[model samples]
Target chain A: MKQSHMAFMESGNFLYTLDRFKEVPVLYKGENIKEALQEKIVSTDSSLSIFPYGPSSGGMVESVYFDILTQGERIQKVSFDAGFKNRSIKLSGLSMGDALLRIERMNGVHSAAYSSMFCHIWEKGIAMDIPDQIKYLRVAMMEAERISSHLFVASRLTGGASQNIAHMNILLLREELLRAIASAFGHRYFFGVNRLGGISRPVNINGFQKKIRQISDEYREIFHTLMDSRVFIDRLDRSAIIKGENSSGPAMRASGIKKDGRNLHRYYEGLEFKTITSDGGDALARFMVRSGEIHESASIIEQALLHSGDLKPDPEVNEGSDSFMAGGFMETPSGDASMIIKVRDGKLESTGFMSPSILNMEAFAGSVSGNTFADFLFGYESLGIWVCEMGDFQ
Target chain B: MKAWILRSFRKGIITSKFPGGRNENASPWSTPPVYRKGDQDPYCPVGAISQGKADANRCISCGLCYPNYEPSMDIHGSVSSVSVPALKKSIRIYQIDVGSCGACNLEIGALANPQYDMARLGISFTNTPRHADALLVSGVLTDNMREPLMRAYEAMAEPRVVFAVGACAISGSLLGKAVSDTLRIDVTVPGCPPDPFTIMDAVQKARGVK
Candidate 1:
């Protein structure tokens, strides 16, 4: 089974592996090759100076340290240290229920994605089948999360370009969506809202589709205005190019790759969410893809709301899985975030998380390299990489 | 520029009358919770409730104690010891992220949106600690961030107000050690990730100290 799991992992496009936690320190024959290469990458010589940006600075939303090796104006390479904010959550030896509380906070903004993915994996392991209404409702909530996340990224992108009006309006739309979500569901960010087999809180998101449509309408105009603005267009165009592979979500789609994990799910079968793509792998392309996805995500929610029934008290998740390991892939707002878990005696033995931000960070480092210092923010914002989600876990 | 000017005028005022009025859009889960009167024994995962009492500083608002404890819908914040009264009119905040789930950071950023409009209260985020009157710290204080966190505080001018913003910072809330273990916090606002209203109320109280 371990060999089969390793074989299964080898068949995929992932670089990081679950083998790291299996007591085998090194997976590949040449383990130090990558580390040695990283050492050479960070080996900045005499002529060039390395500028350290953060650990804590107002320029970033999270505490992340960046070492940008530059020569006068142009950036040569960017190295980041994501260890500053490690919460050191030990998932192993905890009950599945206890492990979940940690996962929800692993990335609070992406709690919908993280919690849903964990529940899905656990359900599959236990051979538990979720009700159709619950699945439909999950789809709606996920899409709502996607919309708000995209709105935020869009706000940051426009704000980076000094397009204050577009930025403010996008924020306004996002606030409206968040309030609507809070009313439709219980929590604003869907916190404590995903149980193992069913939804945590009894929610009625049926009529909320109207509000989703309204916010969609409002965002469309801002989207158009942003596209029409030459200044905004120029700021993003030809910046941070990642010809998206080894990635999952908008970044992958933005790189002209049409793959989305949502397309493979049966719950999203009837929803009219399309996987959008772009020509250039730059910030402009990413912005375009995400802008289009916002509408598609809104449409998915609008349609998914119809299939969802007015959920009553959650079904009792009375069953449990013992001595089992389960893991799978998920398309979070960031990209394709995947996790592998080892369970024994109904407790988590060990867990491996590969958040989309990990892949996006490599792409971001590649994208920002050789570009002028001014392009760094646009590159970072366009990729939608969150350092908070970049931590490697057990 | 002209287009934006006209658009701003057309949009009208959507800002909240917070601090003056109540926060109309506060989320229940993100607000400080209160233990109910009648629950034989409530189980709080974070020890937020003990002996039929709830402590906001330690509550992660995991909702395990729900039906036994619920949100009070108030700002539920307090200025414990001191506040920088000189910053009563205008307070420029420099946010320091020690370590968080990114939720608390976004909630703080949300204050810039049309609904909260924290700028109306003369509150804005500064990119440098030198220009800031207060340091808004969020998340659990990690070992790696201790030096930087302290350096940021040292960089700030005298009469500086420090706000420990979420449950993680207040009591560590099961994630890590509380930030208060390192720094002297003037105000502590609690939630899993305290909503913008709670944060705003805390900020207001810190400035309005007599």
Candidate 2:
């Protein structure tokens, strides 16, 4: 398949270029092709016109460059000459704390995934030998994040339901879940806890298990109450319907596709869990599947905690060989977040990450096509875009 | 539905008495500072404490003190403003930078929330530095944002105060030692991002605002 065009108007800030591929095609105004090419564009103050092309590894633009094909009279293709280069991150030969700090500085899940992809690239080949226990734990955490995120989205969506009680309930429930997660993990968002090797820290099994049980019991009761309420159901039912192909993750799963990372079981083999799927695929169905997944996650966490062992830091694992590429997918709250890594000489040569938000963006664009603008927020909320944005770390 | 409403109403006000009484029961992570001398507390990364005395001016709002600090340390107790030794009595003001990570900014914004209504006290967040007292800043001043930050600081009237709210503002947080000449942050509040109570403590110290 031809590379899909993802055009970004170049801002004259940071552009990454190495001897080869100096000039790239950019669409100018009035359907014209113009190539504004230069070498060594760095620093926000430096005025340089260059195009930064990459699978990943780029910085925010200091200034935007418009394609001036028509003698500056009209505009052409715009490209952001992304500031900073990936090489700036001197990850090699760094202490564990420093490396983790660097990883944290990357900030946001996309950057996390990008750094992970870079790690994969450094490793040169994929490590299929990852412990099943670690894999299961990772999946559980990923699902937990998804569940709360979707719940929050649903809670926020109910603001339009004209019932302040339901909206406040959702918010309160969300806050409760957030506290529970924070209790389990040090950070509310669960950052820096999931390391490249396995997990940075183990869940406080007893405390976390209790919290999870309490939350699950509370949520089950609350959700059951909401579902049984015809008034609430009517507000959510068929309100923001999207087909399976048009939606992502639980939103798509509600429309009936049992594709879950837990099923893949690539990492966590012995972990027993149930995949929540619904056929209605409406706003209500999406909410139900998400709510159900919360239970599933809590179950998985409980299991992981029960089976917990000494969590030791993995020694610096070497990237097997150069010229190797591998991709890892984690089912984020929005959908599947895939990371592709290319390695050369134990260094990240090139990396690309497709955040679930990007996929959900596609899903949202497609789902909202026929719907009126008023229904846009409802449809968007049903798919859980705000939490997706948080996951995007943008 | 009718039954649920009645049950909820019976639950009574879950709203906290934060801005009112000195409620010790804050969030688990919401700890106010307790000044002690030379206590090896691992909560704060930067040495915000000297001889166990927490200089409210030096304290960064990084939640570490509450979570990872000494085991005996009460996170909720640390959520309240630490009384700092006064240099002079002056009305202190605070500023919020929207460009930085929203964590500290959100916590600062939470002051306006019904639960922690900061306006009930004399504290308030102002947009411009002209009407302000102290400046509350967050995030590592990015290379592109240096001018605006400096400009705001310059714009503040004399006898001004500046309190850095997060780790980013203090010690450049995770931005690392690589300092950008153009975008250098002046003050530092530490933590991945500190809680609001930490911020409240800092503001109180700056302006002597009760």
**Which numbered prediction scores highest in TM-score against the true structure?**
1
Put down candidate 1 lDDT per residue, A1-394, tens digits, no spaces. Answer: 2343345345432123222222121322123333534666446544556676776877677887677766667777776667778678888988777788888888888888888889888888887898877778888888899888899899989999999889999999999999888777767888888888887666766568889998998888888877789999999988878884855589888888888989886557767767899878888998988889888988888677777766765754664648888888778888888898988888899898888898887778767767888889899888778877776456
User: What is the TM-score of each candidate's chain B when compared with the real chain B?
Assistant: 0.92, 0.59
Against the true two-chain complex, what DockQ does each candidate achieve? 0.42, 0.12
Best by lDDT: 1
Candidate 2 residue lDDT tens string, A1-394 = 1021111112222122211113323322112122223212223324333222221111111111122221122212222222211113344444333344444434332223333333333332554356655555555555555556655666646665655666566556555555565556545555445555555544543365676677677767777777777776776776556676665678789888887765663544677888889988777788888888888877876776666533544543443444556766656566665656555554555545555554554565445333433444465567754221222221
Best model per DockQ: 1
| lDDT for each residue of candidate 1 in B27-108, tens digit (9 for 90 to 100) | 7777766767674757677877777777888878677666677777666554455666788888999999888889889988
The lDDT of each candidate is: 0.79, 0.49
Candidate 1 colliding pairs: A248-A336, A249-A335
Give me the chain B TM-score of candidate 1: 0.92
**Model 1 chain B: which ten-residue window has the lowest total lDDT?**
B75-84
Clashes of each: 2, 46
